[model samples]
Target: MNTKAFLEPMGSWAWWRSWFLIFFGCAVMGTGFVLFINPYNFVPGGVYGLGIVFHNIFPSVQVGTFGYMFDVPLMIIAMLIFGGQFGTRTVLAALFTPGYMNILTRLVYPDAAAVESLDPALLLGGRLDLSNDLLLTCVIGAVVIGVGQGIVVRQQATTGGTDIVAMLLQKFAGIKFSTGILLADGSVVLSGLVVIGFGIGTAEAEPAGWMLTLYSLITIYITSRVIAYMLDGASYDKLLFIITDKHQELRQFILEDLERSATYLKGKGMYTEAMKDVIFLVVSRREVRLVEQKIRSIDPRAFVVVTDAYDTYGEGFKPLPDADTIQAE
Candidate 1:
């Protein structure tokens, strides 16, 4: 009755659906980088952020090209270090991102032979000198990036770049992925500060200031939140703890009717000093009402406690390891 078992037969509908989501997400993310983030010099971290820094220095090089340059090497390193962890989907995502970014730029500015030729300030009409609005620009661009990244994550694929680096670090150095991302991106942001020359001196082209640094941090925060919302929003699962004497009936309903599993724990009611059987399980938000109704039907006086299970990784939930990486023990 493991729900995960039924998914992902070769070339199945789910397979196509997963790839579609990953590609679509990559396009959205690439658009955000090329059109909004790169133009504004909001270095929010990752390959795209580094690409922005490089693009400012070498205006001739498209930001997507820079991303491609970095992503390929990093992906190779990931493959070498973590066998089976970096799969074809990751490769496709890494490759698709930069190419689509260039494509988006071309679509936005058709007359230009390449995205690099178009003026960076063209989208803003070069009005920023008169009214500096990096904050608003950062917020809008970060939201777009977050939406794209969230969609990619929902498909269980990464856009590569520092995401691969983070995984590698976690695998080899025992660093947590979250911590590794913070450190890697934090260093990138700091580098951006120096590259943009915040408060030191404004260059003739691509002026940088402390505001951009602050905005970059803010953008990262917003992007993380958006990803979380997309991955675990209203549909997040719930963990239930039910203390009931009707353990057999409850277990039967959970196993047969709900097609779900449960764990039983023997406990003593602290106040009543009576032996109690505690049934613990997690179910989707939509299943809560049905479960509650069943509980009430079986044991009206059952002590039920429900809590949010923000992330659950197991047989019927998210896989514990990266789809393409070697699963760590």
Candidate 2:
């Protein structure tokens, strides 16, 4: 019998438990952005941040709310790939975050809130209305947003955002959740830098441009790291499995040109029933192309497989070596 088919439906009690997590996560997502992003007009991370930057660059062109604009499309895409719990969870997060942010916007009534103790350095910076204490905003905002995000992920829920796209790509696009995340998030950050510079007034436009650039970069970095950590797909590596007749030649090339090591696994082709040598090498993702080129040069018919090894261990992988150690090898 199929294990899931044998399982019973989740009860209302279980349903509410998930909703509770989503609600809290959404609340944090909303409140933190309002305090940090909107007040300072700092762009959001990923697509949301990109929207802000886009508006800044092209004042006449108005996209919808950043969260909602990204959420609807992203959730739809995620649902198509993941289905069921994963899809539903992302939809709820995507929808709820924006709504909650709107509600929180009204509640906070920026004018109504008693003057909270802001950092002294920010007031001294004199960049804008809140005072240009970018350091405080960046660090505090990351912590505040990251905490809520961590909680939701721990509960296996989402805080909305482009995380839905990341999840979808992970399931169907044959991509890691973290890599997709950086792409989605970084995509927004990059767009924002370009868009935020559209206005005419130097005083108004200059600050927006600077803040948008800074916010997009930092937020994308923070969110990407946080999401990858939560989802267990965070790293910077490419795992290469090369099956070649030229074993010693390929091995030496990596050790010398790439400054890497390989483990020779004696494998066999199931179909051919012929013995083969498979060389396993772990290198930075950027170096994959070069490695592949060398493999082709040495053995054109070699079977090469490249994959995102989210995390790796052992010699010549990441905790890395000095130039001397690499050279000595």
For TM-score, the strongest prediction is 1
How far in Å is the alpha carbon of 21 misplaced in model 2?
Answer: 1.4
- Which residue segments of model 1 deviate by more than 4 Å? 1-21, 84-92, 110-121, 124-136, 150-157, 176-178, 197-208, 228-235, 245-261, 289-301, 313-329
The digit string of per-residue lDDT tens for model 1 on 1-329 reads 12342355866887778889989999888877766677667789999898877776776788888889998878776556554433566678889999998777766654554355455555444433212577777787888988988788676567888777766776678875545566678878877787774532325433545677888988887776676677556466999999887888998999999898988888997888988778889998899999999999999999899999877888777777554332211
Candidate 2 local distance difference test against the native: 0.60
Model 1 deviation from native, Cα RMSD in Å = 6.1
Which number leads on lDDT? Answer: 1
Candidate 1, TM-score vs. the true structure? Answer: 0.74
> Which RMSD values do the candidates have, in order?
6.1, 13.0
At residue 207, give the lDDT of candidate 1: 52
Task: Estimate the TM-score of every prediction.
Answer: 0.74, 0.55
